[model samples]
Target: MVATVDVRHETLRRLKSGTGKLATAALRELDADYRWFGELPAQERSWVGTVAQAGITSFVSWYANPTGTYRGALEIFAAAPPELTRSVSLQHTLSIVRTVVKVVEDNADELAAVGGEAHLREAILRYSREVAFSAAEVYARAAETRGAWDARLEALVIDALVRGEVDDDLPSRAAALGWKPGPTLVVVGRTHGPLGETQSAELRRSMRRAATGAMVGIHGEDLIVIARSDQDLRELASSIMESFGPGPVVIGPPAVTLLEVARSARAAFAGVVAAPAWSLSPRPVLADDLLPERVLVGDTGARDRLISIAYDPIVRAGGSLQETVATFLDCGRSLELSARTMFVHANTVRYRLKKVSELTGWDVLSTRDAHVLETAFALGRLRDAGRASL
Candidate 1:
């Protein structure tokens, strides 16, 4: 065992003395793997050559004094320009290291005073371990840099959409990130949770698994998913509800295109902001479902929606349905009271309330729907009498 250790140490000593010879042979062997080397860009090919030389030189220095490492043994990778990593993948870089390590192992005995395969192979293994660790460090740093750059770009894209300030360059920038903006999309709820790397990635994975061609962007806690599929967005939101915090997930109205998502985003945001008004709302609630809540909170768009869908339909019908709704609701939803005031039987009042529900889809019997109807009725009357412009 002692002799084995001594011979291995002897091999390291010989290899360190033959650094010049080792570098020449390793470069020659690396060039012989010409197919992959030639395919690299000219600049990258030159980088590979420089790194190969540095690896041999570094190994000799490290073997001469194993504990005496310098700059974390990353000087070899750092010796090349930063663009070298951009041109050469970690896989390619590791391949170069393997080639150089193999050259040292195959030719170690030619430089040794006494040839022994086991001893030289041991020395090669020891040196190869350091090179492998250094290679990992380089790749890890590259990955971190790429991740930070991508995060910034992603934040920019999301901000533009959320702010509705998408520039002409947005399409190309999005394409660079493999984002294909779809026409059919919805800006669902955003920004009310602890967002970390793992959860963020899990959220994106869930979106991808939910449908093909889905793109996700986040700025701060605000996350927007552009789902291409025509499935019900509310249903989609429910499926992805785990991605959110302990608050309402307001789904914007489905948009026909990314460019049209501005309206959807506004609606979703308004719903999110107004969600506290409806304490019993579902976890993933539709933005339009909270129209009454939104309108009360000064959302002109929500008021406009209520006036258009509920009031206009009832007013346009003009079959006494509107008057009966106003009377029944004003009369505290008492059938008898409404009938007595209008000088009709209670059954006649019931028939009119049902008709109003059928026309506007807002059942006057339901307290929430009744409130929406009452607000719409007041707004509609004000508009018709020229007392209000809304």
Candidate 2:
């Protein structure tokens, strides 16, 4: 150890006088060969030149005081005016540093002749690796900072879109996140708590492979996913349904475009809130299919939907289809009782029911479908009475 120190000190003093020459040689080599560096603005080029000079002087100090200089040696470059890191990428900076290191390395034998015991070439190699790692650290920190800002931007977009707020800047922010504006469906559920690192990575990887643009965020306990319209909501919900802590995975109706998806996002959120009312709801439940529960939870939009989709269609078919459904439901879905009420053959009731299904897509024969129609009738009656009052 003592001999190594002695050699380091001796070599350090001998190389001290040539630090100016070393920087000039490095710059001459860079200017002669590296076309990229030559094209940089004059100010940035001056910064790079300062770093080159610092690199040579730091090397001489580091050769002698290995422990002390390793950490602080890079500060000279770090504290340079205008900051060398601003315009010059770490990659380009490393190239400049490499040229300086190479200049010294090419003169390694001559530099070593100053002291027999000093391993000048070995010291340079070790310092070169540390410099590379330090360069990488700066870029890594920048990436992490950018990532945090992006996450905030994404959350802001979700809040605005979900709340139906629109402004001139919304589209630009979406573009920043690489969101492709298209028809979309919003899904709401609870996210499985704090996924393992591997599981979290795989979830993103799987989503990318699916070739569907998606934005995922957590609003309190609800996990929301906005996926492309062509992506099957049921499949997406089912695949990650288990990840939800509890309750149904509710999918909203498809919106024609992302800017128009507030309705879907709102419906998805409302359906998930109301999902507990229906114990038998499908694992991946549809918001449109949850009209009864949504109404029970005071979702006026769901009430409006049922009135429009279920009641209006039947009523528009000119009363026959409407009467058949009302009779069938009142009779507990009994064809005979419905026929008796209408004073017609059961086949006539059946034919009307078929027509009802063709018109409204809800079969009087389906108990669930019938129940939905019942809710629609009650809401539709109230709607007509309110309009009459107005």
Candidate 3:
């Protein structure tokens, strides 16, 4: 009993220190040192002693007067004795302390309402500081875990490839590791906080869910995922959009080998740059043979000029100048087939051909002009594809 009393007193002290005025006032009013069990009539004293001895009176007071301003105290005289046993006997004493603590927590607003501003502010500042310290500790632990997981994941990927555990599409294997070669897709996702240790675990889970069978790596602030199978690439990308909110996703056209993944990644990166104004709606953009073309167009600006020429109102009103050029090129420079493919009387094709020559100041009939236009068209298509991906 003495041990239980000491523990109860200590616990109440902690609760009082942790809380505000209501809990402290309730504890003071309990007058725990007084023993009135033997003084009153048998029935009345029986109820009063039970409440006082059980520590229930203090609990009731704390719970009822949470802000320490209630005019009436709680009356638990008629309540029956709480069940007690050897194991939980100490708990009965602690229950009073817990009750006080709970009242303080639940009535923080009430305390503030009752003009406990200084006390409330001090409590809030202390709680905030504790939470901040705990969060920093958690972040540090996560960072350490992430570093170990990264190394393990990298080794796992390299070992799987070397042991022939993966299928013979070596390019796909290379692409997953951010290597530059083969058909590839690059996906970027935002994390909850600055990159730390748990990110690798979260990433691995995401990759497994995407089922891309690709090697995933983190480069600075970006998540770089590579995969060889176009189907897997598409599925992985779709899953990422669903799991994380849409941002930017880019898929590069199939390359011949793993050495081309870097080129594909660069193309995808460029795509992300082109459409800064456009937002993704959970969709991924695909660029096939257009990647190289886009690079050329972006580097040289000639592709834009070609588009202006092809779609210009003056060119279209006269006749489709670009279509005529396409037919001419497809016919291997054979004027007869070019005229037939145009679906116009050879005389009409000839006249439109004349008009194209006059407007562009280049003879569509010339091999040099044909070559230049074809190259420009290819470049324009690639650039367009890349932009779509971004």
Candidate 2 regions exceeding 4 Å error are: 1-124, 183-185, 192-213, 228-233
Tell me, what's the RMSD of every candidate? 6.6, 5.9, 19.9
Per-residue C-alpha lDDT of model 1 across residues 172-241, encoded as one tens digit per residue: 7667665564544555566557678887877777777886556677657767776666676657666766
Which of the predicted structures, 1 or 3, would earn the higher TM-score when compared with the native? 1
Candidate 2 vs candidate 3, TM-score winner: 2
Question: Cα miss at 70, model 2 (Å)?
Answer: 6.1
Report the error of model 2 at residue 358, Å. Answer: 1.8
Candidate 2 lDDT, 47-138, residue by residue in tens: 88888888888778777778783663345466565345658887887887789889988877666644543378777888888777776776
* Evaluation by lDDT, superior candidate among 1 and 2: 2
Whose TM-score is greatest here? 2
Instruction: Evaluate residue 245 in candidate 2 and report its C-alpha lDDT on the 0 to 100 scale.
Output: 65
Candidates arranged by lDDT, highest first:
2, 1, 3
What's each prediction's TM-score?
A: 0.63, 0.71, 0.33
Model 3 per-residue lDDT tens digits across residues 1-390: 112334334444444444445534434433353233233346643443354332333443343334574221122322433221111222332333344334445555544433343454444344334333443443454446655654666655544432335545554434444444444555544333356667666776677556545566555544555554545556656766653333555564444354444444555555544434333322466533233334453723324545555334233555576677667777887778877887777777677778777775556677656554566555556666899999
